[model samples]
Target: MTTRARASTMAVPAQRRLQSWIKQSRGYLFIAPAVIFLLVVMVYPLANVFVTSFTQIDTRERTQEYVGLDNYAALLDDSTLWNSVRNTVIFTAASVVLHLLIGGVLALLLNEQWLSAEVRNFTRGVLILPWLFSTAASALIWGLLYHPFGTLNYLLMSSGLASEPVEFLGDRALALMSLVLVNVWKTFPFYMVMILGGLQSIPVELYEVSRVDGAGRLQRFRHITLPMMRPVILAISTIDIITTFGHFDLVKLMTFGGPIRSTETIAYYVWQTGFRDVNFGYGAAISVMMVVVLSIGVLVYLRMFTAREQMYGETTTAL
Candidate 1:
């Protein structure tokens, strides 16, 4: 090739390389802020927690003393920690199930065509009040309602619905359940809103076609509404389970894990260990365990949702 032609070819490659570099640099420039923010806000704190979990740090310590896995070992032998785990699981399970059931029912009720638009809107607005209130405020309000001589008990007594006032929050057997009820009351509205939004997005023609085919209400719900709402249900269930599992405010304010630690959730246990007992190292370990458990739950939820979507596709193809 001629010398000039060779020079032109080399220049073309150089120009292409420069253009590629510019594009790559622009991409990194767009992402750099988010990367820095996450490192500062999330990565650094998580790293500190991980480091602290392996040390014996407390109020008295200027520097954390490396204790290896002793904190984790102690947790294994701690009966109170086990009890907290059990309570956390129970609370999470009960709250998530009840929230889904109640919220699904409420969504169905509101989705009814016979309901006036204005009345439905008003009811939805009122339903969100519980969720709008602060968690501390909700806990306080519910705590009063659960009081032996509180308005709920008084009304029940006056109406002859109860033989006597029920010791809702004070009894060991009832404390966790009572907390679950309060949690459900405060959070189910959120699920209702999500499911209602999904319900609204569903094409009305499907329901109309089902009706024309002599499908009853139950049949329509089973075949149409439930199938269409599956994705939303899975999403909401995942969020509700995680939130309920880590719930601290309601349990802290209402029972303080009281009635003999009956409502001591994992989150509250972490708080107690870290702040109240000033055992920051052990608390960090527990927090790490919580992160693992919650991470597993979230992964499982995602897998389940994926499987459901695949099965739904197969069913649709089969039909």
Candidate 2:
């Protein structure tokens, strides 16, 4: 081709690219405000914490000094930090597992076709009551139930299950587990709602077809239900893990990480170090570490989810 002809052809591609860029820019423009808001509220705070973590701040003197990784180095030798890490792991794991198990079972039961609409509706409303309560309110309610002379001890004593009141929130052995129970109670409803929505979205025809093929309840659940619900379960579990890991309010209100710090999670440690002890640099280091751990967990979950989705898609395409 001649030079002019080749140039015109190249210009045609450039013109198309420009038009495509303009089209994409409109979508970006729509989201620019939200993106800007997030940067201001979320990104700025996170960046500030990261910067603060490397400094030694003296609030009394109103001073900041670059201390390199001294804050993190101090965390390495801090036995309380290690203890808090252990507590955080136990609390997060137990809460997530119980939430999934109890929530899954309830969602399954509630999805049953034999249940009357009124009964189902009422049961759902009641089950979701826990999710309606704020963290502070949940702490207060569970606190009352767990009081030494409270309803739980009364029931136990009256039923001959115990000879004395149990110090649910005051005993080191029981405090962590007691807090776990409250966390489960308050958060399971979230899993239930998400799972229930997933269940409802499933086509009834799939179950009917399985039954016609001589599949039993367990078989149908294993093959049809589980595979379909995997995405929802994974998504919710990831969210639960992050939230439970950072949980603080219940421990703060009910136990105050008491009875020798049995319930002192990393989150509580951060607050204690920063506000109560007035060690802002150390607290910021702890906070940054938490963000790192959570980011790693979320990345793993996302990788698993993406792999499973790809495999499922390929399987569908093959069939």
Candidate 3:
């Protein structure tokens, strides 16, 4: 029972460990390609942007010099950056709120017991058409509608609502709201479809039981429907916030951040700064700032979700 016996015992365990490692490595092989792809496409570009943000780039000379936080510092005094930020917040908040309100109501109506299946299906299909169009396509269609010779102006003039063709996309005050309306129109259908799926997943028995207890439609909705749909609502709202906050294509196409840059969002500003103005370093800084803002927003939403759950728990306990 000396060195020979001890060495044999250790070798058996080491051999077993090797076999286990080999077994786990085989599973890792399947995911290795996906991991590499993400690193190449998403991670590398993200890291490059972060690096670029710290440097001053000369497009003419194809060179970069480390400038530390100068790019970010410059943003502090830039009135245009602040303006874009304010516009981005307004556009995102308005669009998300309207999407939720309109989508929720539409979902409830479509899920009504009195609605025939054919009518519901037809209405749903028609409503979802807006969401089917690509952003570029939506911009084109809305562009036509907002033009001086467009149907909207025609109707306003014919109905005596205006003495002239109202510049829907031309007026600075109306441009931002015009974009918001277009965004809401194009995106609410997605929220509606998501809420409808959540509604349908809810067990019918819950409604029956509530009705038997003399709960009215409003009561049932407050007690049962809302609680059940919370997850879907939270998910879709988070997505809407993130996407809407960084929205660019519509603004680019419809307004070009124009009317004295009234409709400029941070996203469009990044483009205007980088490609348009050839300030790649400053644009990268803006992009990094946007990521930070989006991260903070997601964290705040998650925090609210947690607090809501805790509040519900406390309420139940009290009840």
Alpha carbon deviation, residue 56, candidate 2 (Å): 0.7
TM-score of each: 0.90, 0.88, 0.92
What's model 3's lDDT at 54? 96
**Which lDDT tens digits does candidate 3 get at residues 1-319?**
8899999999999999999999989888889999999999999999999999999999889999999999999989999999999999999999999999999999999999798999999999999999999999999999999999999999999999999988889999999999999999999999999999999999999999999999998999999999878878888888999999999999988999989988999999999999999999999999999999889988898678868967886222211
At residue 192, candidate 2 shows an lDDT of: 97
Q: Candidate 2, residues 1-319: lDDT per residue as tens digits?
A: 9999999999999999999999989999999999999999999999999999999997878999999999999989999999999999899999999999999999999999899989999999999999999989998899899998889999999999999999998889999999999999998988999999999988999999999999999999988898888878887888898999999998889888888989999999999999999999999999999899889978887777778778777222211
Scored by TM-score, the top model is: 3
Which regions of candidate 1 are displaced past 4 Å?
1-19, 314-319
- Candidate 1's TM-score reads 0.90
Worst 10 residues of 2 by lDDT: 310-319
Query: How far out, in Å, is residue 115 in model 2?
Result: 0.9
Q: Please give the lDDT score for candidate 3.
A: 0.93
Best by lDDT: 3
Lowest summed lDDT across 10 adjacent residues in model 3 is found at 310-319
Cα TM-score of candidate 2: 0.88
Clashing pairs in 1: none
